[model samples]
Target: MKASLLKEEFKTNKYDEMLKDLYEDASLVDYQKDRYANALDKFIELYGDENVSIYSAAGRSEISGNHTDHQHGCVLAGSINLDAIGVVARQDDVINVVSDSFNIAPIHLNDLDKKDEEEGTSEGLIRGVVSKLKELGYNIGGFKAFITSDVLVGAGLSSSAAFETIIGTIIDGLYNDMSIDMVTIAKVGQYAENVYFGKPCGLMDQCACAVGGLISIDFKDTEHPVVNHVDVDFSKYDHSLCIVDTKGSHADLTDAYGAIPAEMKDVAHYFGKEFLREVDEKEFFDHLADVRDAVKNDREILRAIHFFKENARVPQIVEALNNDDFDLFKKLIKESGNSSYKFLQNVYADFDYKHQAVSAGLALSEIVLGDHGVSRVHGGGFAGTIQAFVENDFVPEYKKEIEKLFGEGSCHVLKVRKLGGCKVVEE
Candidate 1:
């Protein structure tokens, strides 16, 4: 499920295309064949080049479901053309990470097995991946990686997951026999983000970003995620999806986001379970009174309800998509967005006032198109963009409403990309 409708054009293996872009872009300015070539050159200048190879991956978009992966629910997602490319030159038993995306110091694996609970950012993320790989008995050695990316931050896309997966893939390509699977890659990436990055995040971002394409990831069991690829072809219908950029400011989402999954877990724990999915309708209703009594916040209760309901909606949407019932699917998205606003507590986060983006986008959209326009919160739903199914005739009207709020380039009209995920080219 690429964000771009031009699936035929996007190279199946994003790394290969990114590599070419890196070479061509850097070469236009006299750049090396690989962006990290300079870093490898520096490493050799310091020590010596032994056995080194390069590998990479790209970011992904949540095509259908939102926040469902954490609850062991369903999510329709896939990789995007934009990615981070890393060229690693393996060396001694040292694991060094050189990143162009993050302008920080090069990371060296001295005590690679240790976790730094203090400064939780790039280094911890890198070390986190390395630590997980080492724990998994993966052969990890010294390598210099240069990274570059097109994935934008704060856009509701999983950029961190993309970087981590690329790092893991680079490591796998360098040492392992190229027998790495997407699930393993996803876990290793999640390990880095959760333990290393210090973000109490869920598996959705890592899975979506790692697996790529339109996949239904079932996390009913946290230890194993069952990923089912779904075919999403909406071209037969004349409708299009335009994510409205409600030109609203966003908050620092770190701590605020940390609260979401934590709180959900709390609600589930009230029913004696790991996630809302584990608690059956009977168990939830049976313990509803206890849950309400135990939790003081009303929004918490509402969010709990939203999680359960949204979880159930994933499969329905998948069925609707298969039947080409865009109308039904469109209606479901609106329902999900409304629930997120009313229950999930993400509709309007207090941090930096991010909720206004979704709210304003919906307001403006409704003003222009009476009933044909369906707009709701997209992605994490606190801000950024809202998914809107607009009438083709109302394109100009939709653009006007969107531009007035988010400026000229705020709203994006996108079609579904079909080519799932794969390595584009070796050369």
Candidate 2:
């Protein structure tokens, strides 16, 4: 279908069935229509209503295994309903993307080499994904896309990974056969973020955003992560996954985010290894003093401890979910939150007392939910959002209480989406 036809379909009810299938909620029909209409209009305006494809990539929630993936550890993560969508049409060799808020120039695919000037921008991610795809022997071209997202930017939702996966999905749908697996696409996204975007992040975010569902990923081998899609339904237990965006800024926190992997690697280097996963936990304990002296930072040792323990916790949580043990799962979630606060030390940035929104939110959740829910520091920690699992019946009151502190609509009630990165509608 051309952009014009797609717009017409949206105006009518032709896409209602498709939207129901995509969102799984009949109530979201109007919202979906408005979203798709805006994308279609933007596409028509940018490229003059030629035939185009629509793609969507979801943002992810880290269910467990906080700060463990960077050490080549395990994690249980899921793709949320929040996503980044693109309206794209194949171009000759120039990739032009007009995102919602950023003013990024179009990228020419013929010049896909890394440019220091483009680091830390959305253009870097685009170029890096294309470069990685081409290097991996995949067909690469260009497309003009109008991208928009509802994924909260600095709120631990993996928005950057969502955008990268959207680009990868477009490439998969357009040039190459859409047969490229989600894990490969996720790896490409991670490569782009690590090399091009100048963020030394782990594979968990990209994998979760690309794999979808409630998955337990074992990054024992970073190259070939074992992604197990666990069949755990929160609705069955009257629970909802709620993320509270405390509205904290991630600005000037690169050093804080970068220090996690770097500190873990520092401890690993003391053991003559590259990542903490390679070092035996028993051996780390045996040489605690020596390792502490070598790193000269007690916080690094503490972080390494969190890495080992959190890696071990992933399997336990996976088992609980597999056995339909909601109580155990909740218990483990609380434990993960405690570990992140006590050992991981990521509840709030050090020397930043002015912004302790995460800590305050967690404290408030503990008081409000009591024994009915579980809350934790979400995603890359330091500052941003907190993840909470609340009983469905209590959601309205929970949202009200939290919003009073964090402001209205700061709490997002999200579902675990089944699909990851894919072409949503094609003509």
Candidate 3:
């Protein structure tokens, strides 16, 4: 377990053989391969090693539950083929990190275990995690790393969460020797994004991306979320899961995104509370006027209300899926959509594009699939992708119509792979 021994193993592992064996046609998607290649090239250039090992975690599509995660509420989500992958070669005392999509230099691994926000840009997520690992009293050896992500940034697919999860797993498996629990590692990734990277996101994305599979997260106490993995067969079902891009502009929506959690905290303060999740829906609404006046921002109260309703819907949605009740699921999906639009109000800024994407899918699902299923806004919902549970029989026809609106490849069929944070084929 010496650092030098691990470094030697990293350089000698049959990575090509491993990748070829690991990347079954079903194992990795095309974009992931490209990102993995890019990361490998960076590893070769920076660390002078053609033989760096790889660890990967895939991005997720929000199957159910939207803006609710911010309040530490429930979310039903699953992982997709779009993954964030990394290649690591052991380096003595200094771990150099490089990312493919962003033009950032290899970060020093030694300094990383103690990163400062001013010194680190987006890369601070990685440095901060490493730094915290050491503080947690873990044995973390240094390595040169190259990371690449094919998950579309700002697409609501949570690309950053995917990356941070994989990086945390890499540290736990390769450096810390998997001493930290998987959930704890996932939390570290979330902390890296929230505190170090300055992205005001919640734990659902990181947890969903890291945990993989179809699961409902009860963020009633975000620090201790309750998770229940659902067992459902997506392939046997006769329908397609589609994403229709709303094409709603997110420009100038930065503060609107940040304001959600901040205002929720303000709402909590109105009642001398912590998070809006702590309050009941009727209790929250019975005092809507007072809650509205207390927060002073109509939008914040709206966002907080959505959290209550959405968290309540999580169990109902999961039950619909478990019982194969398409009608129930579809109805719930539409209700969730309306809540995001009317209550959460993310759709108000640019209603037209959101309409084009969401309304079109809703209409199409009704027309084409008959009584098959429903569609809803996938994630934060400013304007990106809409998640629809489609009828398997009419999937192609559904994709054809939706693609005409959002371009080809807009709709993707994904399966739940709940392997959790894994490090396979280690050198």
Candidate 4:
């Protein structure tokens, strides 16, 4: 169907069934329809009413194992319903993308080499994904797309990863056989971020956004991570997952995020290894004094300890979830938050004590939920959002209270989506 025809169908309620199938939330059907309609309108405005396909890639939440993925550690992550959506139509040789945010990016697929001038832009991600796909012996080509996202910027949700995955999905659906696994798409996204975007991020964000649902991922082998889907029925427990955006800026925090892996690797270098995961916990503890002396950073030593303990906690949390032990899971979550605050020391930048939103949010959540729920510093953690597992019935009250501190609509109730990066509309 053409873009114009799709718009007509949307107005006539011809696509409501499809939307229901895609979202699985009857309550969101109208909202999803409106979002798609708006994207289609924008596409028609920019690229004309050519026949286009729609694609979606979900944003991710780091459920557990904070800042451990870069060191080949274990983590539990989930894909939230928030996502990036694209309306795309195949083109001859050039890929043109106009997003709701930022200027238009046009990339020539034939000349898909890293451009120094394109670093830190969406064009870099597009070219990187294309280059990676071609290198992996997969099909690649050009397409014109209108992209938009609900993933909040700088809120710890993996928005960049979601956008990268959206690109990968568009390419897979349009040119390739659409047979590339989500994990491969995620790796391509990570490649884009690391080499093209100039960020030394781990595979966790991409994997979580790409794999979808609640998953237990062990990155012991970076090339082939072991991914297991954990069956968690949130409705059964009467709990809701909420993310509170504290409106903290991530500006000038690159060094803070980068230092985590750097210092952990420094400790590993002290023990003749590459990552903290390779060093045994007992050996690290036994040589703690020597390691501290060699590294000469007490914070680094504490971070290493956090990594080991946090890694150990992943499986226990998974086990508790598998056994339907919400209490134990909540307990481990609190412990993880405490470890992140005390040992990892990423709650706030040392210099910015005046703006401690994460600390204040955690403290408030503890007071509000008491022994009924769990809250923690979410994602990269220096500044952004906090994750809270709240009782379903108490959600409204919790959202109301939190919003009072962070302003209106700061609290978002999220669901774990089952699908990752994929083409939502085939026609």
lDDT of 2 by residue, 136-205 (tens): 9999998888999998888889999999999999999998779899999999999999888988778888
Question: The CA-based lDDT of model 2 is what?
Answer: 0.89
Provide the clashing-pair count of each candidate structure. Answer: 9, 1, 5, 0
Clashing pairs in 1: 1-213, 1-214, 13-423, 13-424, 26-31, 52-90, 78-213, 79-213, 94-142
TM-score of 3: 0.83
**C-alpha TM-scores of all predictions:** 0.78, 0.95, 0.83, 0.96
Winner on lDDT between 3 and 4 is: 4
User: What residue pairs are clashing in model 4?
Assistant: none
lDDT per residue as tens, model 3, 1-427: 2223334444554244444433322444443344454555566666665445567787878876777777777888877666767777666665566677464545565566434543337568777677777777877777766677767776788888887787788888777776777667778887887678876677888877887677788877777888778887655556555666656566667776777678878887777777877766677778889988766788787778777887789889999989987677778878988788777776444424544455555555557655655766768766676777777666787788777766788777555555556675465
- Of the candidates numbered 2 and 3, which has the greater TM-score value? 2
Query: Mind giving the per-residue lDDT tens digits that candidate 1 earns over 1-427?
Result: 1112112223244344454443222222223233344544543444454343445565666755567677777776666545665545556665555465345555566676545653467777778887788788888776665566655666666778888887777667667755678778889888887776777677877877667656777887779878877676555666656766565556566666667777887888887788777778677767787888898766667777887888788788788888888889878877877777777867667655624667776777777767776776767867677767787777777887678867897766554443322333221
lDDT of each: 0.66, 0.89, 0.69, 0.90
**Candidate 3, which segments miss by more than 4 Å at Cα?**
1-51, 101-103, 113-120, 289-304, 324-327, 350-370
Q: How far out, in Å, is residue 222 in model 2?
A: 1.3
Model 2, runs deviating above 4 Å: 101-103, 289-296
Q: On TM-score, who's better, 3 or 4?
A: 4
lDDT of 4 by residue, 1-427 (tens): 7998887778788889877755545777789888999999999999898999899998988989998998999999988888899999998999999989576667897888898888888989989998999999998888999999999888888899999999998989998868999999999999999998887788998988888888999999999999999988755777878999998888988888889999999999998999999999999999999999988999999999999999999999999999999999999999999999999999999878898998999889989887668999998898999999999889898998898999999999877778788888775
